[model samples]
Target: MKHLKEVDAVTTELREALAGAGVVLPSLRPDPVSIAHRYNPPLVELGRCSMEVARRLTAALTPTRQSRGERP
Candidate 1:
């Protein structure tokens, strides 16, 4: 039960973080297999998104020139 809660918290955190970056993973959630009380640690399912969303996620993950202290 504790593990499940923790995993859920993680999922929520990730969702909020991604939203902050303008990235919304529609199917984001905890992996059922991993959260079946069979594993100590749970896995997060990012699910699939459109190419546009994927590109946006990649851009968010990547540091831009300005973010790296360089002029664009």
Candidate 2:
């Protein structure tokens, strides 16, 4: 139907937007270990640390939102 087509179009647009934003959706055939091995452990560690800090900051900010009675 026309609605189905519209829904598909919207989904495709959302996927493209997420890809542009550097988010890769689940893929059935991910590249193997050889590619992963090329990544430097230090760089990976830095990214992990940065993500942890961001998560902690977000968690810390949530209390302020709660004090203001924000929904989340």
The true-versus-predicted C-alpha distance at residue 40 of model 2, in Å, is 49
Question: Where does candidate 2 have its weakest 10-residue lDDT segment?
Answer: 40-49
Q: Give the TM-score of candidate 2.
A: 0.36
> How many clashes in each structure?
0, 0
Best by TM-score: 1
Error of 1 at 48 (Å): 0.7
- C-alpha TM-scores of all predictions: 0.90, 0.36
Q: List the residue pairs that clash in candidate 2.
A: none
Q: What is the lDDT of candidate 2?
A: 0.43
Q: In model 1, what is the error at residue 26, expressed in angstroms?
A: 0.8
Which candidate wins on lDDT?
A: 1
Q: How would you encode candidate 2's per-residue C-alpha lDDT over 1-72 as one tens digit per residue?
A: 343444455556755654565543443122233224434221111112355445654564456766898878
